[model samples]
Target: MGSSSSPSGGGGGGNGSEKEGNSSRPRFFNKKEKSICWAKAETVPGRHPERWRKDAADNVVCKRLFNCLGCLCFEYDHIIPYSKGGESVAENCQILQSRVNRFKANKDEVDTTQLKGYSCDIKFTDKELDIIEMAVYGDVIRPGNQCRCRTVAEMLGKYKSKDSTAACKLPQSSESL
Candidate 1:
């Protein structure tokens, strides 16, 4: 939205800037507006058309998994930024993966080439996507066998397995890669 005026409500909520003037407009795009932003993008061929847009740095963004991290969950971005008087409407909205959006926040002058520089080049497998979904949203459907994967929280910082004995020690055998 290059012109003035913005929707009064948006679920994603703006960058939380309480600044006065044009910057004090609706920052985040609403659900309907988010969908409109997605609709404006080019879809990846042979992929789920409604769920997936064209690939960005080998990352896939699913509309249903908005705002999640790692597995390329995405958010509706302001193309021209409300802070600079950009309106909060479909024309000014663009969908960006969570990581990329965070890296590109509030910048009005970014191009597709620059987008690649701001993207993630890692490509994950289907099973990895499931694990990512589980870690981020804890909503993966495990078909059978009860396999426990460590949550990101447990994997971060200090971790001591409860299943281990009081004194846990690794074998001195160093395996070469």
Candidate 2:
């Protein structure tokens, strides 16, 4: 053996450091964490009418819903507000929170609705964003693991705050498209 500066006792620097690495592996998220993720993932699928199918297909549907996309039930969301000349087609419909849909009240909210009558790209609320983030990240363990869910929103918000023309013209559907 090579000349040892310190013996391999409890005070041994090399041995102590090496032993630290052998400690029990860290546990993954506990049951509560899993439940929260599952709930967040399924929120949209269970609530929205038009989006339920897509949400189910995207694995955002709750496990209670047959755990299959085909079995998911959906409803209609007005892509273009009836007041603003929107259609009720699947392409135009979306899965939205009941509260959100009610808030809009069968008409377009100028601030939330796009000018050209496309509601597919929605302005998400914080709760909605949380679910989107969870779905994209597959579990929120670290900030470094953040997904691209809000990147476009952040960029758009930033550009709009600065009144940047480039960002203003960016197509709204691009976020999910």
TM-score of each: 0.56, 0.23
Q: Worst ten-residue run, lDDT, model 1?
A: 163-172
* Candidate 2 C-alpha lDDT tens digits along 72-169: 22222344553344432233444332223333434554343332232233444434533543453432222233232334656667632343212112
Task: Judge candidate 2 at residue 72 and give its lDDT.
Answer: 29
The lDDT of each candidate is 0.57, 0.31
RMSD of each: 9.8, 24.2
* Runs in model 1 lying further than 4 Å from the true structure: 1-24, 55-59, 124-177
What are the per-residue Cα lDDT tens digits for candidate 1 across 43-146?
Answer: 75444456567433335776666665654667677778765777767888777777776666667787777777777777666555455544544344333312
**lDDT over C-alpha atoms for residue 45 of model 1:** 45
Q: Clashing residue pairs, candidate 1?
A: 1-92
Compared with the true structure, model 2 gives a TM-score of 0.23
